[model samples]
Target: MDKIQNQVRPVFPFTAIVGQEEMKLALILNVIDPKIGGVMIMGDRGTGKSTTIRAIADLLPEIEVVADDLFNSHISDYDLMSDFVKNQLENNANLTTSLIKVPMVDLPLGATEDRLCGTIDIEKALNEGVKSFDPGLLAKANRGILYVDEVNLLDDHLVDILLDSAASGWNTVEREGISIRHPSRFVLVGSGNPEEGELRPQLLDRFGMHAEIRTVRDASLRVQIVEQRTKFDQDPNSCIKEFCEQQNLLKQTIINAQSLLKSITIDYSLKVKISQICGILNVDGLRGDIVTNRAAKAFAAYQNKKEVDVDDVKEVITLCLRHRLRKDPLDTIDSGTKVSQVVDDILS
Candidate 1:
């Protein structure tokens, strides 16, 4: 069993996850529309945050790419390729193409700036007296998920790099007298325990949705959590098999949702509703309103609806605006609750 475990590691299915519905929903929303921005899953330790992310990685479909491309550059992005590749394509060279699983690149706590944004390959330079842009984690994560555990502990410099890349949808690195740029668009997913530290306000605002999770409280529910975890550990294949139907259903739902989002109607009143809620909450800037609008549409699409409704707008207010709320010393109410209250006043 130990050897078997070592050879084929198994992940707990996303559908089998017992609780944290909001966390799961937040992640799913991103899948439907990555432009809704990334997700920040913050909570106490051992809350299965990372496990949920891994399960999502398992559920996502593979993507087509140019074979042997370090950046996983799509054919549509051929213009961004190096001069060599541009010339080859111009000459009708035989460039291989293939399908690969959507990458889930982990950004470790100790990752350096070079590791994140990339630098010239040091090993090749020393061994062969050659220089090449060894694409970094950001490059690998392009058009995929970028999972950052302990995101609060990320170095300040790396945070800046991520912010810049995420904002511009590209990363340019200059090293060894060579400059290279590539598409670095990705859905950023981060999880961290608040006991360690709070993330910077700037970075927090960057996440499209913020979900604060807690341990299962009800005794029976807690028991199920433990039981399912044990069963999964002992027989992951069997556990996953049991959930296969629901898993496949959810996978298809998201794929359909992606198509549905493009056609989902965004009414003018819906825009007013979003603006009113944001205005009532005193949320800074326009990000809260924008994220809420996108999230609401994504939610409608997820539910197989063709148009955005008031209820749909109501459902996502807290997740979209919670982290954007300015600190209020006088008001003791929860920020999530505040968003709910303001939403009621404006939309009701």
Candidate 2:
């Protein structure tokens, strides 16, 4: 029964997902250049937030990792390697590698700190003199994606923990003076219904981009979404087969973009303009400027372009800055609108 339950299920192809272009673009941009950080998606309920996220993760190409490593340590990068992998390397051990689907870990709202960050078995340390540290979700999420549904409803402290690891690209566990650190670098994707609540500005700012989605209002598009979903539900395998071409095309596009991203460059003048917008808006930090630059380059790469232009920066400037703006409870202007206005004034 357990084996049957653990069998992999077919995912709805990412290309089949209709609408929510902003959310999809943000997710893709982050995947192309993880240095752009991750995205925060707030939307109406049942707006395909979770489905779209999962589809993108499933769409990603497999990565090679050191076999049997709990952290899914990259095959080469020392920083991304786990301590165990490092020790083996120091002892001149040859590491076996395996290809695996990019991990997509869901953070349940009720998770405790110890569960989220991992815990050290104090007894083993004291008695056996061995560090029996049990890995948690962050450890498993290395070189993958950590998704938090209903992120606004999650505890603030937990949100901090996630953002810290996402920003620093590492998770450290300490117990009874035994500290264990491992690579926890992963694309941090969080989605929630804005109707329920909103993450605080500080926590929201930690996310690289903000994408807002609403339920599809067009009757024709609505019908298409429903029919497509019905088809997928009726026969997941056949439905996936139907869109296999589009899915493969998109997956290849992402791979190409990732390879092209490093060569993608942005103009210095445009970067100065990005910072100007942030300054005019009184954005709290340089994250807005930095993310905008990275996202613009990623956007360019995604389009198979070698250099970022004004349009590329324009396309992502709002997403990169919207969540970082200071909240004025009395102000009526929407944050996104404010960002757009500033961008237009400066970049135009």
Give the best candidate by lDDT. 2
Model 2, 1-348: lDDT tens per residue?
A: 323422457788899998889999999999998878899999998899999999999889989999998999987798899989999999999989999889999999999998899999999899999998889999999999999999999999999999999999999888778999999999999999888988988899889999999889899999999999999888887888899999999999999999998898887888888888999999997898889999999999999999999999999999998888888999899999998888888877
lDDT of 2 at 176: 71
Query: Which ranges in model 2 have alpha carbons more than 4 Å from their true place?
Result: 1-8
What are the lDDT figures for the candidates, one per model? 0.86, 0.91
Q: For model 2, what is the C-alpha lDDT against the true structure?
A: 0.91
Backbone clash total for model 1 is: 0
Off by over 4 Å in 1: 1-7, 77-87, 121-131
* Candidate 2 residue pairs that clash: none
TM-score of 2: 0.96
lDDT of 1: 0.86
Tens-place lDDT digits, model 1, residues 205-281: 98899999998789999899999999999998899999999999999999999989989987998798798878877
